[model samples]
Target: MKIAELGADGTEQAYDAMRQLRPHLTSAGFVRLVNEVQRPQGYRLVASWDALSGRVVAAAGFRVQHMLAHGPVLQVDDLSTIPAARGQGHASRLLAWLEREARFLGCAQLHLTAGTHRYDAHRLYLRHGFAIRSFQLSRQL
Candidate 1:
């Protein structure tokens, strides 16, 4: 397996992967969002692909954003491994790649949110040196 940063040509693959995980996003909306993130001055989308089969097995995306407490932090918005490709260390490898990238970008810390029901993912994050920092609160508009 090889980890590659999704470039201009890799947008379609990244969109497909995200749509598979999040079916609610329409293709048009997803495309627009991808373009926004792929902008030269914005966030990055990194994916791990299987070299032999040419399939994207896992992905982790982050952006350097400012916060009151941390100043500049790497906010990981998405981390996903294809269902069929889980338990193969793809997620772990992608996370390792993200950590390196975060450090290289001079981020003060890495931050993310996991769903309350995703116990397995929570455990994985804990194993990776991420602690339960705080509860996420939100209200629908």
Candidate 2:
């Protein structure tokens, strides 16, 4: 397995990977979002690929920004391990890599949100040393 920063050439693969986990995000939307992130700006997308199979097994991304209270922070936006690739430590590897990258970027903290119903993911996050910082309230626009 190899972990790499996704470039423009990997947009289609990344979109397919995200769509496999999140079908609600349309292909066009995923492509557009990816293109926007690929710009020389604040966001980054990382992918874990199985070199032998040429398959993307896991992915995670983060947006770097400054917060008044937190100084520099990294907002972890998406973290997904392909259903068939779970239990293979792909998610953990991706997360560890992300953490290292965040540290390299001089981020003081990392934040993310998960649905309340995603208990398994919650457990994984806890195991990875993430605490429940606060509840997120959202009203559909």
Candidate 3:
């Protein structure tokens, strides 16, 4: 198993894996959207590849920023592992990597919002030491 920061060269593989988690995005728009988010939001992508097959099985989209609540934080906007690859520790490995990266960048916290219905993911986060500190309320504008 190998974890790597994805660049343009890994975009296609990353998109294919990430699409499983965010099916609303079309292939044509994925790259464009990632680029747009990166420029203004400090967005980044990382992927985990199987050691033998060498296929990207998991992906994460995140950024580092400062906010009043947390001075410098690494906030994960998206994290997904292809269904077939679940339970293989791909996401866990990625999360660990992110934590290390966060510390290296002087981030005080790591944060993410999971949909209420995603019970399994919530379990994973809880096991990783994340507490449910607040509810994230949103409305369509």
TM-score of each: 0.89, 0.89, 0.94
On lDDT, who's better, 2 or 3? Answer: 3
Compared with the true structure, what per-residue lDDT tens digits does model 2 show for residues 1-141? 788888766766666557755789887778777777544576677888876688887777678879898998888877887787777887788888888878998999988878788788899999999999788899998
What would the per-residue lDDT of candidate 1 be over residues 1-141, giving only the tens digit for each residue? 889898656765665556645678886776667676445557678888877778887777678888899888888887877777778888788888888888998889988878898888888999999999789999999
Q: What is the lDDT of residue 96 in candidate 3?
A: 97
* lDDT for each residue of candidate 3 in 31-128, tens digit (9 for 90 to 100): 87887656356889999998878899999999998999889999999999988899999999999999999999999999998999999999999999
Q: What's model 3's overall lDDT?
A: 0.89
- Backbone steric clashes in candidate 1, count: 0
**Which candidate ranks first by TM-score, i.e. highest?**
3
Going through the candidates in the order shown, the clash numbers are: 0, 0, 0
Best by lDDT: 3
Pairs clashing in candidate 2? none
